[model samples]
Target: MTDLAALRAALQLQWALGQEILALVQREHLALTEPGQRSGSAFEFFRQRLHLLPRLEEAVAALRRHRAAWQQLSPALRRSDPEIGALLRANEDLIFRILLLDRENQQLRLRHGLLTVRAESHPHSNRSTSGQFSALA
Candidate 1:
């Protein structure tokens, strides 16, 4: 296959991988938010997603390396490689969404301390010795 064809294929693969990673992240959030849910499945999904990282990175790197060659292609060739523009736009949108979701996840982790809870009946029922609310109280 031509370099354009290879790059286009790579872009498609990366897009698919990105979508999978996003879905896994959403699943992880679900695992976090549900009161009785187990996080093991989400952790497994994360492990699977991690296995895909190097392939995704290689595909992205290959595209970057071939970008100069891509710019040299004729307009017709560029237009024929539809994956280029579509993947670019989709990637941009996905990246923005992923960043927003990741930030929210970080905040959730900090706020709930990974959803840890004590045997106390009420959240405000326990107070520290100084009359201050603390997670460890």
Candidate 2:
């Protein structure tokens, strides 16, 4: 396929993956907020993401290859191609939203006792911890 064709395909895949991941995060956010839905909520979010992992990896590799193709395209072409430009714009918007949602999810996790602020985050404490504790730090 042509470089333009490949770039288009890669952008499409990236957009799809971003949407799916965003949906998963949104679901996790909703799960965290709802009352009386405690059983297996975290596990369900993990299971969906785990199932998406292979597709995500494959898309990453494809995008890496496409990155070279994108670089090969002339700046004029990049500016002129409406579909490619729109896809890139949409991808950027989706990324911004996903980040916002992920931050909200993290705060929700903290509020719901699924996460702790960690020792380092505390102003007075210099204590060392391991595993999840270290992760939070």
Candidate 3:
């Protein structure tokens, strides 16, 4: 496949992974917010998030592998390619939402006296300069 095609595919994969991560976080929030939620359920949610974080990291790694190719394109070309631009924006939005929900979940978990897990516990998770989670480019 061409470089553009490869990058496009990578973005698609990252987007899908990010969507799953976001949904999982949202569910964790729901589980935490439930007044009758069992500790076991909360722990299960935490474990699922841990396992998925690494997968998200790998997906992000794949996305970054194509960053160079994306950077090689001219600004005008990138602007004109709606599919890629929209997909990238969608992935960024997902990453932001996951971070927000995860933060709220953490706070809720803290109120419940349950320990919190950090994404940094995963060796491969990327960090953006702004300290938010890395968004797939």
Candidate 4:
């Protein structure tokens, strides 16, 4: 017996938080691109301030409980409730996009690391042979 209005509001809040996190990721990506930029400080700050992300599993679990309760509601209630449906759909899309972005970011990081290692290991070997010493000298 969940409060439908409260459940809907919680879903909306979770969706909003996800959208805010996405915005932060975009900002971090921009900061990551500058040649002379170091994101260590920003990352540390975010690590301290964004601890909510780790606790999101709790929020997600709550949402699941609420969703289950919603599902057990009468069919007429579900059909008549557009706000709940919209909130669920938005939250689902946000979570899916977050997962997709995480995978893409990991792949990009691996590729970048490989490229850096290759570049460091294989220095330019093709030196010009214009300067020569004669054995006769």
User: What's model 1's TM-score?
Assistant: 0.58
Q: Which segments of model 3 are wrong by more than 4 Å?
A: 36-40, 61-68, 116-137
Better of 1 and 3 by lDDT: 3
Model 4: per-residue Cα lDDT at residue 31: 43
> Residue-wise lDDT of candidate 1 within 1-137, one digit each (tens)?
35766777766776776787677667666766784765655346445545654654564555565555667778898888777767666765764565466546544654666323442334465442212111221
Error of 3 at 50 (Å): 1.4
Who is ahead in lDDT, 3 or 4?
3
lDDT of 2 by residue, 26-119 (tens): 7777777886554446656656656765665565556556555655778887766668767766776776686677667666777766665662
What are the clash counts of all predictions, listed in order?
0, 0, 0, 0
Q: Which stretch of 10 consecutive residues in model 1 shows the poorest summed lDDT?
A: 128-137
Report the C-alpha lDDT of model 3 over 1-137, residue by residue, as the tens digit: 23566667878888888888887777767777876653447557756766787786676666555555666788887766668767776777777788778767666765676653453244465654223222111
Model 1 error, position 108 (Å): 0.5
lDDT at 45 for candidate 1? 43
Model 4, residue 111: distance off in Å is 3.2
Residue pairs that clash (backbone atoms under 3 angstroms), model 1 = none
The list of candidate 2 runs beyond 4 A from truth reads 36-40, 47-72, 119-137
Candidate closest to the true structure, highest TM-score: 3
User: Which residue pairs clash in candidate 2?
Assistant: none
